[model samples]
Target: MSVISDNNDFSFKKNERLYHRNEIQELFKKGSSFYLYPFKVIYIADPFEAKVNPQQILISVPKRKFKKAPDRNFIKRQVREAYRQHKILIDPEKLNRNLRIAYIYTSDKKMPSDVLTKKLKKTLERLHQEFTV
Candidate 1:
């Protein structure tokens, strides 16, 4: 794991968010996936080619599982927060590729923030292992 020397490294910036419709579709079509309890993580590592960020991510809480807008929003917030805190676990320099990742909330019920964070941290650590290999 690479050390995050500056506090600014923790910020989740706008460019780090993956929101383009085509890119999202392509991710679902081509990315590899794994289920980690509450989340279904899908990811693609593309050759580096002038990407704005080494890593970009999408977070989704399906409306079918979480009918209310607020519930979906809250879950998304928690997932994003957890990912933001632990993202450094995946070292971009080691991977040498741009990664596009999606964290799809798979659980039917809401999880406590602490539990969610722990799960996400484990998920990220697993991803790091995969990418490095």
Candidate 2:
């Protein structure tokens, strides 16, 4: 067990990432989702099998929205960093099954990193409130 402090000492490990192609497809195909402006979040609670981590997250930047690879990669970094900072808000022990979450970039224009960070926080908070209920 780990205790998350009110500090900036957080890490995003390999286990916490969503990687498998099939899993990503499943998440997109059947997961419940919502949009927060430039971001569209899709999540599935209690995935049938136990995974290596309690939560697995994937961030996607559509090529249509970001024509350049550099732009897409930059946005991906921003999303990952935001999630890493606020992940402490979610406690793994409280949930019985794995939570698979995917963040899809949906806008044509780019927004400031601060705005993305704020929206990511709101997205995570909404996820927490959603499952806790």
> 110 in model 2: Cα distance from truth in Å?
1.7
Candidate 1 deviation (Cα RMSD)? 3.4
> Candidate 1 at 92: error in angstroms?
1.3
CA-only RMSD, every prediction? 3.4, 3.5
Give the TM-score (vs. native) of candidate 2: 0.86
Model 2 over residues 4-111: C-alpha lDDT tens digits? 663445888898899999999999999999988878999988743544578889999999877899999999999899999888776655655578999998988787
Model 1 C-alpha lDDT per residue in residues 1-133, reported as the tens digit of each score:
9776654388888998999999999999999999999889999998776545778999999999999999999999998898888988886766777889999999999999999999999999999899777
* Candidate with maximal lDDT: 1
